[model samples]
Target: MLGPETLSTPPQSPLVPVLPAYIPPDVDMDVVLAEVAADGVSAAPADESGLQRVVADAQQQGIDLKVVVIDTNPPIDTPLRDIATVVAQSHPDATVLVLSPSFAGTHSQVFDRVTLEAGEDLAKTGNPVQSAQNFVDQLNTPDFPWTGLTIVLTVGVLLAAVLTRMLQVRAKSADAPKPQADTASADS
Candidate 1:
């Protein structure tokens, strides 16, 4: 998870552009275009100013600002990957930032679940960035993925302890000397 300062810092290396090789059939260009427009991006291939607007909007929405604008459409199955690969191949060390409406769904889900578990109202966070950071922190917690294996191991340890205690108690009682009753002399 990136802090606000890290997000604001410009990338040290130049970002390499990667476009999707194929556009998925299900991708609705009109919907995509409308979303772009809403982001204040007037052109498919956003110019410098348009990119800045995108970065600003994303920062406001609590998204990473290292963006890789995909000018052309890509296959639905690997839309984000196709673009990422291109940039990755050219700039192996650079981070790939994909901006798409599709991402909004999953991001919201992550934020919601994290906030729910924290017992905090999402609105109280006051910004998308904070919400996103909280979600990331939740994910990074040491016991984040509490797996079935962990549960089983814990139960096994507890059962062993109880059984050991019970055996110790039984052995101690069995080893004790039997109690003897004293008999009084019979009356003449």
Candidate 2:
């Protein structure tokens, strides 16, 4: 037979293990480009001629080039625009991607207008060179989910402690000595 305290105690569940967070690898331009190309088309042209060559070659290969341009100015330069136009012309499905470091606050407004008109996606890089490198680095790291696991583990620990305490109290009560009652009788 169990006492009221012991009978009312609930069974505790096992502790849930906590998993570590995964940090994603740094971004790699080569790998990124390769992945893009593998799915459809890719190109990295250095100069005007190279850009044209890549555009023409990608067209022949039946792939739409995805241009990634990184600059440090606002509104974009005429030469850059010309190159983008050439690429667009060669591959009608191509997208002119632009990343600029100088497009912040007031400068960004100009970028937005140009990007909208040109049908391009312009992202602010903060610092073109460093940002590019950082992006690549981020791609190279691993990613992990930590917050959810921590919550589960914390709950399990709390429950385990409560159950241990209850068990101890139950055992102590069952082994405790009780007082004996005595009766006195008078002689007749």
Candidate 3:
């Protein structure tokens, strides 16, 4: 499994840049500002000071910021819960997102309970539209369900082969036992 550091780093820019820095005149600044103002911040703090940066930024903006902390194989004495408590105390409105990639089952349940009680949104993060599209595409793809057209074609070929073999076996078995009578007459 990839460590928290790997997941926390923002994906590097592609080999080719997708967009230029300047915005065209046709684009409305108000709309852009609104989008920017509404945008949420995501972060993974390694320590208390790192966590403070996000809370401070959200407080300054007067908008709720979502904080995500990723920890892999954290120790029992880790300050994750304490950090979360501090964040909630400092920024009551902000939602903190916590993900534990290394732990599953009961460990996740405990985390979920804590996050919910604290009024935070806890889950793995990614593009929702892309995630939905991927699921839809997988369902639509030909190979997912094995009992579709491909299976029917394969079964038809196998049945045809079995019938052909049965016919050949019957024809050989049905041949007369004339040679036995000839041998008996020769012996007589």
Candidate 4:
């Protein structure tokens, strides 16, 4: 019978640079961080139960887990990719995942490249906190990011066109002169 100590382990290799870095092969998670941390690693809020559990699990397995909680409001100039790059620089051999929360919803990255959003079950539940928590719970799962952004953008464009047409019609109607009553005919 296999036990924890008797479990088979994979051979370790020197970390190498990978391209199109979406979801690199499995390695023990060593660091977690937000995009803005000057150093890829830092203390984050204990409220994130999923992250906390990951840290604890790593410790139990004797793997060094570094946690970096990203800033709630990241700078407009700093994108997710940039943050991941920064984290990678700090820990070249380390695997980086970004867990971001927002009022709209929550999402995470795997392999530091592939974007995976939380399932819709939480969002439809109408609880922001719970929805965000649901997002955290599904962070490590093999899911794809929602493509609703494209649809949303398309809707926005269509709406703008409709509004512009309505304004043009209104302007033409307002500019036209009102028909005057024939006072002379009435007097005759």
lDDT of 2: 0.41
lDDT of 2 by residue, 1-188 (tens): 96666446666654422222111123244553453454322223333344444445544654343444433343433333443443344445554433334432111121234333323222244543333333323322334456778999999999999999999999999899875555343332
RMSD of each predicted structure: 17.2, 24.3, 19.4, 19.4
Question: Evaluated with TM-score, which candidate comes out highest?
Answer: 1
What ranges in model 2 sit over 4 Å off? 1-98, 102-125, 151-155, 158-161, 164-179, 183-188
Candidate 1 collision pairs:
22-75, 23-74, 24-74, 24-75, 24-76
TM-score ranking, best first = 1, 4, 2, 3
> Which one wins by lDDT: 1 or 2?
1
For residues 1-188, what per-residue lDDT tens digits would candidate 4 score against the true structure? 96667667886656533443423332112444332233323434443554556545544644333334444533331343444455656555444334334322212232332332233233223333344335334444655445777888889999999999999999999999999999999899
TM-scores for all candidates: the values are: 0.33, 0.30, 0.24, 0.30
Q: How accurate locally, in lDDT, is each candidate?
A: 0.43, 0.41, 0.39, 0.44
Total colliding residue pairs, candidate 4: 5
The count of backbone overlaps in candidate 2 is 23
Writing each residue's lDDT as its tens digit, candidate 1 over 1-188 gives: 96666447667653333343533444444554454335523223525464555446555655433333343434242554443333334435332333333231112222334433442222124233343344334433555555888999999999999999999999999999997655553432
TM-score of 2: 0.30
